[model samples]
Target: MRGDAETTRATGSPPALRRGACPTLAAPMQTGDGLLARLRPASGFFTAAAFLDLLDAAEAFGSGRLDITARGNLQIRGLRAESVAPLSAAVARAGIVPCEGIAVEVPPLAGLDPSEWADPRPLARKLAERIADSGLDLAPKLAVIVDGGGRLHLDGVAADIKLVAGAADPRPVWHLLVAGRPTGVSGSVDAMIEAAMSVVADIAAYGSAARARDLPAEPLPPGSSSLALREAAMSPVGRFDLGASVVLGVAPAFGQMAAHIVRPLILAAVAEGVSAVRLAPGRAILLVGPAGWNTSVLVSLAASLGFVVHAGDPALRIDACAGQAGCASGRIDTHAVASHLIAHAPALMDGSLDLHVSGCAKGCARPRVADLTLVAMSCDGRPGLSIVLGGRAGDSPVATKRLEDGPSAITALGQRVAETVEKGESAAACLQRLGPARIAAAFSAARFNGIDHAGL
Candidate 1:
């Protein structure tokens, strides 16, 4: 399947979705079961009825399971082949417009962040709508960012045009980021969008056929030009001040939530006057509107709804792909084991930790480093689990080491991690203070049989 084929549909005509070899549809794709509807969420804002329409569509066309891609878009799978037209209409009725141009991403709280000099969502809408409305005759690999004042940064994600908002000016100055690097400054959103549109024209005329990363190729395409750069005035606000990781880190049991549960969650958040509700990459909902609301009540509502509340709970950092029944590639029910480990979270977290539960070895949920990783495999006619730990992310990152395999007990595994961390050490001490050698041994013994799993 060619990547261009998949991307073409995103820029294809409405009503009739183009055919592509890519398994994931940029436009709608019909199979015997249903149409896989790929939605484009530019600013991540949807009406309440529109939100419920998604619930209805999932129930009507798909398998009642919605997949949130890493790019912050929603994918509906398992739809009846005949339901394509109605499904598309339903999505349109739900207020999600199919974007036909470059994808743009920004901080979830771009508009409402109090610390930001300007709201980026309204302007982001202008940029996207302009590109679509202008009927630009060129395909450009362009992306833009509007950084809000909050600490929820957008770094790991790639972008072509990034507009950071917190500059020294009284009004937010828009700095045009080209190829993930700053290119120029503009006081007006219109001017910023115009500059990016020019970059798109350059791509169309010059033959910068590859993504921004592939710029090293010689004999560069037809049109290529250097862009002027600009600097943003730094503010006094701390960079990581985006509060907790609670935005998208919270997950529901089985990664499932009913309309009753979901609506109330949105209402609770809306009552606090949140600006928008974004489907997070972590397969969770991020309610962004205003700050300083009743944290306890929100936590209570989410907990009551059967979501594993991560509010202030540093231990619940593990994640998994849809394993077993949910995915054809999965070999085990990773969600079940992850749930079991989470229940005994107090015994699992050694200082701060992150884990990933991959069904087979595909590891779709996360590709980056984690403190612990549990990869599933079958061995010796029995289901076995592989354990890896001591991985890190960001600068000087490392992947977890595979320490054990064979039917390891999840609870025992949790206890082993906890016991290793609480070695009469201060909370501020680094995770390695527990001694990597000791943690490795505990994992080894537990995989074979050190701790009991009577109830499990």
Candidate 2:
């Protein structure tokens, strides 16, 4: 299939199997809002001019809302059937090409980081070319990561195959990891690629539903070695000193921003000497520039434009879907409720708290398990929010409450939670202290009597 042809539906209608396929620029998936198309930059980086042009195309052809996905791809939401072709063409004209074949991801600072164990770009390029020409049928979501062992590592991101740089015990080596588990080590890029290709080909032959972890364990590739690799500790957020220059990581609230906010932010970054904007894992935009660039000013500007500059920001603790405003399947205003909960009780952001406010059971925003998950559901034929503890969105709820009572009730619950934690207790310790029975009783009491209390 041609690269541009993948951007739209041939019949200009919604795809029949929306959930089964990956939504690319050529074939957008039908969502509650409208058609949603995702674009992956060829080089994992975008220029300010190219980004602004793409933003303009989104505003002109689709809804004026853009989302930066967890994998660092750009998604244009709310597109009409007819708009896909034009949007795809405009994007191509702006030099933005969607990635093809099994996606191979690298860190945002792939080649520029001088302190890296090895530059993974050359190997990444060779792997991409091989995958494109291999003709091996692979699953759409099958992916690989090439981590060069820089401060910004890809250890946290999930991938089918991982090629991570190993420590130089005399010489630098690359460890071939499958499903986050290291299998063997290679001293050269070619050897690593050969091993990875063999594994990918084996996976392709195992049928579409098969994954790397599903395959049986096998012996390491010939002429390869084994080494114990340790995951590097790093934060993709915050400022990083890149030798003589600096890079600032800026995150948008919920990894999304209005199209209007995007343009001004890009223009401001360009004006402030930002040459290229790279999207990093964890949904951060890295602004690269000279050594003495005014990062504080740029950070202030980004904050004013509704961007999250601090890693400790309360908004980072809450993961919410588009909710009623953007998704038709949403039963409640998840963002509103999340904001209210954060503002009413600030203790939720104290430490390592995983809070997810999903619009529906589909859980597009966060599919992973969280400490506190609120899933939209129907109660007594009325829209409600199901409270799930230490589970995912699709998990059975421990309790349910009316959506109308969500704001005040959740606020009260947050207060109770805060008070429980204020007694010099950890979040986990507080949860253990306030058992499920007592917590459910408080939620029920808050919903029934509409009273605010700090006791559970």
Against the hidden reference, what TM-scores do the models get? 0.67, 0.91
Residue 328, candidate 2: C-alpha displacement in angstroms: 1.9
Clashing pairs in 2: 6-26, 7-25, 7-26, 8-26
lDDT of 1 by residue, 1-456 (tens): 235443443544223453322233334555333455666554465654477777787777667766555545666666654554456667777777655565566665455455556666777777767666766543333555665434344554567556665464456566655566544345567777777676655555554343444333234234433333223322111111244312323445534444556667767766766545565444456654443444567767777887766533432356676676566666667766576566754565443566777676656566566766777654445555665554321212122222233335455545655655556653224345655455545545544444433212
lDDT of 2 at 40: 82
Name the weakest run of 10 consecutive residues (lDDT summed) in model 1. 232-241
lDDT of each: 0.54, 0.78
Instruction: Count clashing pairs, candidate 2.
Output: 4
For residues 269-333, write the lDDT of model 2, one tens digit per residue.
Answer: 88888888888877778888777776888888888998889877777677787877788887777
Best TM-score goes to which candidate? 2
